[model samples]
Target: MTMVENVRNGLLIGAGPRGEEGREPWFLDPREILRTVRLRWITVLLPVLLLLGLAAAWTHLNPPQYAASTQILIDPRGLQVVKDGLTPPDQASDASLLLVDSQLRVLTSDDVLGRVVDRFDLAQDPEFQGRETLLGALKGLVARLTGRTEPPADPRLAALRILRDRTGARRLERSFVLELGVTSEDRDKAARLARGVAETYLARDAATRSDTTRRAGEAIEGRLAELRDALRKAEDKAQGFRARHNLVGTRAQLVSEQQLTQLSDQLGAARAKALEAGARLRQIEGVLAGGPSDSVNEIVQNPTITALRGQLAGVERLRADAEETLGRRHPSYQAALVQEKAVRGTIQAEIRRIAAASRNDYQAALASARTLADTLERRKADALKVGDDFVQLRELERQVEASRAVYEAFLVRARELQEQQRLDTSASRIISPASPPEKRLGPPTPVVFAAALVAGLGLGLVGSLGLELLAGRVRSRRRLEGHLGRSGLDALPRAPRGVAGAGAFRASFGTARGDGSYEVALARLRHRLAAAAPGQRPLVVLVTAADDRTGKSVLARALALSAASDRERVILVDTDPKGLVTRDLGAAAPRDLPATLRERGTLGEALITLASGLQVLPRPSDLPRDLAGRLADALLRSDADLVVVDLGLVGGNVVTERLIADERIPVLLLAVSARRGRLAAVDRALKAIGAGRRPRIVVTDVGARD
Candidate 1:
């Protein structure tokens, strides 16, 4: 069977009587909610109209604010014209973000804002002076009512506060561009202020850069003077050290060292000359001491000696001739011998003279060499004595050179800084200047109205739900289902008043003249019962209520009539001890079901057939103890295609409970009026029936009773 059928037949109450496991709760019905909203539409419209009127008045009383913005590009590369040991601009993501943030702070800083304020004389502007606007007036009134006083503020401070509030700066996403904006009541003023802020910031930045360069140059120049003094002092100390030590020197050599070198050269030449003279003296002495004069090259090569040797040979020849001619002393032979002797004597004198001269020359050379050696030794000692002073002089000269080098470096830097001061410019520049805006700041009037409408509708829906909750009535099928914890079958209209006995049933369920809504409700209930069974066996529909006045008997008869009109065999059983079905259907002298069962042993004998072909089984005034058994037997014996039992005021009798407990039977809970206590009783009845039997709730007398 389908879930709906199972629920109707009380086969799956664990899933909730209304099959609410996967279904929306009955109270959430959109149509019902809309109906509630329609009933209290004024609640929604009031808020909408009120908000719209307030928006209109606000717009009329207050002047529109206009916003103007200027764009600045923060390019670090712009300051690359001169490098003066300043930090280079970074373009990496992290560095760029930091630089942009720092620049943004500077752009909105008091210094930049102060310049703008001074340029525009904003301290005198009425807006900046805190003139009483609508909001300001409201604040003042509230302050007065609260008995609070505010201290007077300085004009400059007030102008600064207002300027800061109206001006803002933000960097464009992932870029070096910044957008500075200003808002004011006057469009021209807004544009001018925006431009003023941008210009002021740029000018301040440039001035800061130039001033920084100038200060750097001044510092370098000051340091340069110190270095210059240090260099001069170093040079003077070197010169004084040299003078104090008597350490005189050319750039490449000392004076004592030069004298020592000259003496060393003179000593070497004198020693060489002495050795030559001694060698010549030895040769002459050897020749004089009986060595062969002719063997000596010096004596052999002498011109006087050579001539004397020739004369000696001639004199020997003459003497030999004289000895032979004249016997002992011939005068001519004697003359020849004398002449040879004289020539020999002359040769001997010349040799002795040359040897003497050689000795004298050697003696003079030895004396000169000895004197020069003595002078050279003294000069070397003097040079060694001044070695420490020369070292100190070199250190002083090195210090002077170092000082000069440092001075030159600083001097170069100072010049560069001076040039930088001349060319200094800001890293940021205006990329797009501010212009007067055509439209005001905030949303247009129509958009505000639409927003108010939506807000009003939402509040209206909330109000409707609250009102419905407050009423706490089951006025519709959905409300009935929600109240009873079961699916609603149908909502039957109340019968017209003044119709008594069977006339009420005729007016509600008459085939030709019945109320359309009541008849249609009955037909719908009949169809639901047929659908719930869907079997060849007779469909048993039990109609019960929490209490009387629920019109359960009337609904049971109407259901039977609606089925009979469809050409189906329908039996209307009134199981109430009050005989409500018999009285309402106008069935005269209805045989008691139990008595008929005891006498005839068949429910067919007790059934009263109506003119509409609907059979009725009316209950006695007092129910018998075995009434449940007799009713079951009577139902089995009958051949009706549909059976609708009227069990009035359920939970009041044991027989009704026993009949409702049957799982095969579909029960309809009639709810004519919903009260908190009555709903509680219905809930208790459902729980007592157990999850194995779920009943369908039928709301009757809907509009008229609720």
Candidate 2:
């Protein structure tokens, strides 16, 4: 029989039902997924082993490559022109990173790569030039036959590409050092290429620096010429202004000091001479007046005046003698008197001459003093004019000095640039040269194998999971509810070991009332059923399963037993033709369900009340096809506060379908653990029945009953 037909037969005869069975709980059940994977062990293991083998083969075929590395110092400290305080720490660090990155780009640029290629003559190398090997030739032939375009054949480009791939440059973290590495099949070749690339880069960097410095020097020279011309013009303007103002001295003075000093001395001498001359003139006048003539030093010092005085004294003596010798009018007395008068007249003439000479001397001295005073006043006026000129002169001097200073500064900068152009080089340098590598860079044998194993296992796991999901299994209670558009009532555990029939499980269901996992699950199922049924008046619940081997019969029994234990009268009608429930309850089959449908028997005549106040109507009938309305009518009239019906194997069974089609009855769908394709089929079937009520779902175990 087909699987569905067999399941239908099993449900009727108390045989273990079969088909798609068992759904896991809503959350991911890792244990179940793992169990599924284990079930397809070969499918998982074969691919894994194959992948590992391929990895191993690849590792063996490929030759190992050696890497050679050189260390370069990226000294951008020279590029930091700003003072430390001027730049923030974060900004400085960012700039340094940018500078280092720029240098790294240059190191790997086409120019540097081309130079390395040329210097090493990499065009002749087979690896770089992509020379045709036997395998490559075959592949090319195949491509041509297949009308495929061949790859480019430029040897220089090919060499460049190869060189780029083999070379790498990276900056060491938080440091000014860079590392350059080259990989090659030949250890010595790798070292040689690495060293060659580094040297070529250094040379290029130096040449670039020299070219930059040379251009800077030329620019500085141009600026220097402009500054020099400006300085010259400033100096010339200052000089011309100085000449115009006659401000010729290095410093301005208040007066012509030397001339002023000489004139002052001359003026003092002239005043002294004038005072002496005036004193002499006064003395002469005093002597002529006959007042203290002895005090007249000038008259006493004059030889002519002294002689005249002596003669006058002698004449006076002779006159006195004559007067004594001869009485009145004697000739000797007359002659002495006349001589004394002449001497007096001569002394008067001499005194008058002296007075005239003194007046002439005083006039000459006054004239000299006046001339010295006038010259000194003229010198002071000229000195004041010179002092006024000094202000503009000093400003012009300052301009000239400033321009000169600027011009000289540019001249010094230009000279420095010239020196730099001669000796300019890059700030970076290769601190350590590459050497031949002692060890190959490829993974070791053991490590490769281990990694291959891990990778293979991962691929296998992924492939197995993919297959399991693709099997279209319902997989979880959440998915089942999603397909059915309703929530599940419960998720019950699998029956424990040695628990055989639904009858054995139900008989002992309430014995372990103390929160055993299975007992708790059944109690929850009972509670949800009560809640799902419409308000209180003898709620009739129809419990059916999508597929078989799920404990639909046992679930109904547990629900009725729970209601009975709660002091409510409950009845379980096993509508399945198999009489599985009747055997479990140890109750004889009541009357055939068709007899009751024909009104020969009542539902109460078929009811058997247990010690727990729960009643069972086992194996109601081998349902008659045309008695659908009669069976539903008899089922509804049972004598109980609650009615639980176990309709096993729902789809393709007309009797079960007829019972589920009752509008007043609520349907509870029981899902087996493996609900691969059956849950969807059951959903479609129920929809076709169109009872206008969504069935509540309950996930159940397949292999074991609960």
Candidate 3:
């Protein structure tokens, strides 16, 4: 499709229903378009704002000056001539448009503006034409600073050019319409410039008409002289022919006399011969046919005799056939011979009849000769009577030729005059005239406004979408779960309550109802623990976290419920000094490591039973070089099939490190969202925990979706 066709098709289709199966109504669905626009709003608006700001600044800071125009309308035929009409001469539409554009160039030319500058003495101005006064010098200094007062063109031409550049003068497409526009801060100046163009057009029109008419007259005069000379030559040839041919009438009369004499004699002789032959032929034919024939030609001319001869021939053939059937000496043979003889005699008689008929034809020729003699005498008399009248046609032909010459000259002159009149109009027609444009032609305001609005919207969308694309924050649930390397058993939203509700995990983990948040998390963890190492003795599950406040105590409680809820006794340990996990889960504050070691009991006695089947033990407040001191009292979950111990944050710095390290307890790694749950962080924590033996990695605070 052509560009125009595509544009037209788009317009037509845009106006029609544009929809697809299972989609929103085309025009009404702004979501996709709006989304794209929002994404680019900032990109589009920034440039628009710049343009608007520049426009505003220009309007405020720049002093507006008026632009004027002076137009000279030329016929482009190079006629330099004028014709009828007060308006500019009418021209072909295309030619007229060309003239307008050419005029535009001429108006902007430096030569023209130079004249205006010199005439106006513009160099003496305060800014331009003024003399070098203090104000002029100050303005010059300012111009130097701003680089404003620079011109490569003549001032007058520059002025005109400024006007022309701001103005529009063009013929309407394919029509006899021309408009001129001049824009200026001074409306009167614009009007004056436009009016001046019309004035200039009028002057041009007059000069062109005068030149056209004058040249036409001269051309016609020159052609007419050539025609006159040609006419003279034709006439001279006719005159010379007449002088040379003095025999013209004589030759015509002689030829006519000769033809007349010959025709008269031949007519007389033909009549005499026809009569003599008729009498002689009658006598001969009468004797032969046994009757006095009116004319033998009449008898001989009849076709019946020839037909009878043919019949006789057929009868002879039949007789011959009879002879062939019989013998030569028989009666049948003799009879056939007799019949053949009779038919031959009849043929001889017909020949005699023809000979008798022609003898009269000779007599008739003699009679016709006598008759021709009389006719010839009469024609001779007629020819003698009409003397020299045959010569008149020759003189008449000369007169006709002379008249044709005169007519040809007159026709030539008339055609020349006709052609001159036609050239008179065609040679100097003005293609277009000057008039103010009703609507100014320039950068369209509505388009500019629409563009700016779209640009602004686009810029805003761009800023928003760009930030989204460049961001390295939380993305989707899949990536979050991938970091954990396990199922996201449960999750929490960003709640203001923090970790206080962790006691529910403890309660859910076979703990008392008063210990709320920790019970819930523990129950989930306990379920995992029971499934992971089912029906195993000394099923110790060591818990550790990446950082503080990651619900380690709660996990231990939930794990304990999974173990002892089925009548299995379970022990819990908090190796974190801060007791953050214990406090959030409503457990008693943890004691110092040294205090536990100082007790009479071993590590098993350090555990405090919070409910029927669950017990809590936390990290110590003092230092213990070795947790092996408490290992002697290490509490075994005799009443439970599983046990969960909170090893707290991983590292040698933590007090629980050696308990797992030296004792070789099975450790479970726990990570939380607050400590940056990314694959990199997970890998780092994995590496740290892997320093001793591999630990089971678990995650906390992963989200769930509908």
lDDT string for model 1 (77-180, tens) is 55667553464644667876787789999999999998888899999998787656777889888998998969768898889999999899898987889999
Clash total of candidate 2: 10
How would you order the candidates by TM-score, starting with the best? 1, 2, 3
**How many residue pairs clash in each candidate at the backbone level?**
1, 10, 98
TM-score of each prediction? 0.56, 0.42, 0.40
Tens-digit lDDT string for candidate 2 (549-642): 3366666776676566666777787777666787766656555556766875677776776655677777744667787777666666655678
For lDDT, the strongest prediction is 1
Task: Assess each prediction's global lDDT (C-alpha) against the native.
Answer: 0.73, 0.70, 0.50
Q: Which residue ranges in model 3 land beyond 4 Å of their true spot?
A: 1-76, 80-104, 110-471, 479-490, 494-529, 536-572, 577-579, 582-604, 611-614, 623-669, 674-683, 686-706
Per-residue C-alpha lDDT of model 3 across residues 1-706, encoded as one tens digit per residue: 1222223322221112222321332113244335434445666567668766655554444445444433333444444233333235456667766765665555444444444334444344233422245676898799989989865456454454454455566544544334555564454545555555454444444556557645655665666666667656665654555455432333234444665667666765565556556654655556465664335554445576666667767777777777677667777777777877777677557657666556656765766676667666776776665554434445544665665676565556555544544443323233333333444333445565566556655565556455533432222223334334433323322222322355434444343332233333344445445566666566677766655345555455445544555456666666565665456545443445456566644554455565555666655555566654354235442334555666656663545666556444543646344223444545555677665575654444433220
Q: Pull out the clashing pairs in model 1.
A: 10-694
lDDT of 3 at 202: 47
Better of 2 and 3 by lDDT: 2
Question: Lowest summed lDDT over 10 consecutive residues: which window, candidate 2?
Answer: 10-19
